[model samples]
Target: MEANSNIPSSHTLWSPHDTVKDAAESLGIALPDEAAKNLAMDVEYRIHEILETAVKFMRHSKRRLLMTSDINHALEMLNIEPLYGYDNTQQLNFKETLVGAGGQTLYYIDDKEMDLEKLINQPLPTVPRQTTFTAHWLAVEGVQPMIPQNPLPSEIKSIPPFARGATSSTLGNDITSSGLSSDVTMKDRDDQSRNKNTGLSQNASEVKPLVKHVLSKELKLYFDKVVEVLITTDPEKENLKYAALTSLKNDPGLHQLVPYFIQFVAEQITNQLRNIEILTTMLEVISALADNKTLFLDPYVHTLMPCILTLLLAKRIGPASKDNNSSEAEDSLKKQLAVREFAAILLDHIIKVYGSSYSTLKARVTRTLLRALLDYSKPVGTHYGTLLGLKNMGPEVIKLVVIGNLKIWYKQVIEDSNKTDYEINILLNTILDIFRHIKVEVDNAENTSDGAQSISEDVKLKLEERVGTKLAELILEQPDAIAIVRGIFFGEINI
Candidate 1:
């Protein structure tokens, strides 16, 4: 058979004649035309066959590039001796040298020679320790023991807030018991059976709801002690109250008591409406809880909001004016204003932090404040709280709600003769403060010095028309009155 005729054209485009002739020359063998042709085709066929099998190995290994080891595996499968000195990871570098005259070139492997003497004198490598794992129960009879041998569950993955509707001590899913019913538990079932035997199931129709979390006795004691310290008439316990607030703000692992704190606040505020000190203390608790980084308070923010809004927008936070003497009433009024101020701050913080959790939370809170602020009958204290809330909502709320409706509220609530001069002055100062705390840097910030020092009588009437006469007169007192006035009507910096 003719080897050249049998060789596929696809396998040998350049032909292997030159390679075979060089090999025969090195061996000092005689070469003939027919023998060289046949040998050349045969070598090409064999080389192609080896690469085809290597390609299959590359594909089987799910690799795009074929490695040297794949060729060796293919050679072994074909019963051929693979060429030595080939490593899968090592690169084969070929150094080119200029050869005989005419600028000819020769390329060969750039192998680095090793020193056998130096290698033999080197220190022997240390033996690796044997691989070992100790046997330990991860969980015994459904309860995970807190041991160093077992990894803690928290390190593996984070438990999302409110993701677990219910949990069990024995809720093992590793080829063990099924889940417990939401409405009942194992202990409840046992108690029901005992009750039935004693003819008591007739009275107890259903089991009470399962506790969402098990509160430790230590936490309950701490909570009760904190509440007692905060509400005690004894001024000596002020240190203890400060310590409790500090712990509530900085301590970790207090997630279990978040709901209880919110509840304690709600109940205290309701029962102690007439008591300013208690109401202020409760607001402090809410603020401390919000500041705690470890507590997942997002789930309980909705429940805590009512207490904040109540304190913020309530008509009267302290004793009725008619029931108390003038001095006592004045002091109580200051306390009321303080409670409302703190409540407003807390509400603004909650909306900013958890606003993304509920898309409409900010909007709803803004609407509530607006309603209280716009109502002429809602007392001056309510307007003060709402203004503070709107101010804290950011520049936009201040610009749109507070500044836009300042005329109506200032004229109706601020100028009301029914309210005391002290209350009116306090509210007026708050209006000025809304402008003071408002930090809007206009493009005309540089031009404030260049602009007119005072508002002319013409723009003054427009300013008074914009915000009530009282606010207009006060705004004119500032050096940047022209810029503030421009920012208000022309959207420059008034808010």
Candidate 2:
């Protein structure tokens, strides 16, 4: 068979026969031309293979520059002995040598040998510093801080001026003085020069805007996977749910996905109100996102608050079972209560975490709950939620909202006989819970005159009357009712 004229016998990447022959001569070996050519091709192929493996090592180390260790590791991986005594910090310099009448060229590494005696006397090199890390704010509120650790604006403008100008203004002003007509006067020349200089200054002042960072495909895939796992209901997928929550809670780059997560939670909560599992999961996702210290959720608090409030104040959450058994009813109620309780906890967390960041957050939450609570037409479940929501805001909120409107709310409840025993019990328990925090101070009547004790008794009666019959009766039933009433009216306890 004949070979094609266009194809070479071996890869051109291989070193020339003369260079291989020179290497063989240095070792006192006389190599044939065919052997030298074969050895050169083999050496080239081996070097290519080693480099391919070395690139893997570089990528694994998260480095761009291929290091000496990477090459050694690649060699080890290939079951070959690594090159020795090659200092990674030092660059190898090669010297060129011309040989024979043919003017053939050969390159050899210029490795200077050192005397053993002088090397042994040299002091040991200084130990390299241990790797350490220091953290600083890379950016705040979407703007990079001009810190010493960050690159300067000039350094960041690394793109060529021509590349930047190509994307900028299209209008070009050629202000060469030679282009001016011969008939132009001195005044015209001066004006043209001044305008040209002004145009140049204007062009110099213009700057190309920084390109906005976009989410990478890998990040988008990760986000979608997280959202899918979070909304999954299978019991076996709990690990996925946990992993998704952990990622949402701890990932630093989730700022871009904050609005998306918020919207997801809102949409799921709206669509899956009857599915307690989904509602709870969505609430959990929101809570996890809120817990992430790196995410700035203050901007989305308004959007998030309504979803949380809906879960807290929804009339129905878990589905009611068709079976009329007491156990099923109890189970349904329990699930509803659990969902509301979780929502209340989330609400409290959001308020504490972001109340100061958003100045109107607390007020806005309080107003929404108050409106629901005071509405006479609202369902009993909503009233229950409103009371619980106020309860979660702490004892001070309970006093301001619950205690202040107790009489009016009591009248409404008393007039409405349609309200169930369960609803009435929840409302009463909520009131008692608020009253429990009100500490009563008793006057030192035993040490004082009888006149002081009579006055204290009168003050207690007035408090009982003001609180109305039902609350007074509930308070009086307690062992320290008189003292409690006296404290409510005359004590230093602030609302």
Candidate 3:
């Protein structure tokens, strides 16, 4: 019998007996025959357990092939220290050698040591570049875009068909079934046979429908023409301008053009700060778009709010014409005030219509207007715009923001020693208008009450002090100031 006849053929052929004998010889000790067999069996069982655990790591990493790191991780999980100096990226080469006169072959992996000096003297590798990312649409509206990132249609069609039916039919069969062509039936059958031979279905392969986005040429031309007429500087095109505005207001299929119009308006407002005509036209466009019941403006309210506020609070608008009389300047100021008032009305409409949808919309608008009002660097016109903007926000905002800040603002900014009496009176009258509105509400609240409208004298004195001496003096001058001030401070009446 052969020397290896005692070993079972079905069991693993690799034996750890040689490794155990070699280790004992290196230590100047002899491993007995029976002791070597028992140690070899123990080592084989431990290796088998490790390999089984390594397979689990392979599946967890979504890989079919086992790796050195997997074995190391398995060893760590089993509470055993893993072997070092094994590079997972390098392949291991095993050498077969004949041992002694018995002609038994031994397979051992070769692990050569590296020279420390040579390794340290080698040139360093170049540093790698930093990674970056970019974004593009892989699919749109349920169809994959034909970009480099997605596989081609031909590649997808190359996949072999199975027992399941195809998702769609071919063009030839579609034509033949529809009775559009009579002679193509034989050719279609021949193609079907060929497809079946190639493991494709006889039922035609499915092609995903391509959805194309297309804007009409006429609409594009109309959009361009309308914009041209609206922004024209020629005095003769005033009628054309009105026609353009009218078309925008009533046009049915202008949903796509709405963004373009908004962008155009924003650009024009920024570029044409000195052109009142352009500014006016932009405002009109906004109004017309807002009034169109068919168009949805909710998504764009934040974008539009800034432009409207700019019109209301800009320090100077329109060109200063040369050699202007006082009357001309006054008329020009009136025109600006009119624009601000119109913008304020539009803002009021925006808040009323869309405020409930956006939780912070009202607060954001109120803060912006208040900031503009408190900015002392701004001219009286800006201050007036801020005042009008606050008033249009309704009684609650006026009571919360405008009423509390009025006395300090009037004393510091409105009563500037350099300002003319006319300007000061204009500012004071605007302040007084707020008080007047509050007074009307107070009167109504008092008349509707079941009991007499009354406040303790001490509480009344404290409320007067909070109103500040300047505003208190102004309030006392009014006919029903006491009732109004009490109602306002106590929140019994809305402003």
Model 1 alpha-carbon drift over 4 Å, by segment: 1-213, 323-325, 439-458, 490-495
Instruction: Give residue 11's error in model 3 in angstroms.
Output: 14
lDDT of 2 by residue, 1-495 (tens): 353432335554665454687799999999876677788888888989999999999998899999888999999999999989878889888999998899988898998898999999999999999999998776676456999997686865885444444422211211111211134444565775577456564446546568555688977898789888888878999998998898888989887778778888878987888898898898889888888989888667767777888888776777865653467766787687788878888888988988787666677678778877787776566777787788777656766787778778887864564765665776787667556556354444422323233334455456556677777667656554544554455444321
* Model 1: per-residue Cα lDDT over 1-495, one tens digit each: 596665334334435455666688899987765677677777778889999999999999999998988899999999999879888777889999997687778899998899999999999999999999896665543456888986577853463222322222222211001111223445565675575456634454434345355578998898788778878878888888899899999999777677778878878887888888889888888888889887777667667777888888787787777734388777877888889889888888888898877566777678777767878897777877888888788767888888888887777876654787777878878877777566344665544543444446677777788887778878877666655666666543232
Ten contiguous residues with the weakest lDDT in model 1: 171-180
Candidate 3, lDDT over the whole model: 0.72
What TM-score should be assigned to candidate 2? 0.52
Report the alpha-carbon TM-score of model 1 versus the true structure: 0.54
Give the clash count for each candidate: 2, 0, 0
Clashes, model 3: 0
lDDT of 3 by residue, 1-495 (tens): 686675333233445445766787899988775666677777788999999999999999999989999999999999999989888889999999998899889899998789999999999999998898877776543357988878787876775433222333432233112211224656776787676666745575655556454569987899899899998899999999988888888878787777788888878987887887788889999999988887878767756776787888888777664533366766676677777878788888888887876666777778778877887878667888888888877778888898777767776776654665555666777777766665544355444332123545565465555666666666556556655565467455322
TM-score-superior candidate, 2 or 3:
3
Collision pairs in model 2: none
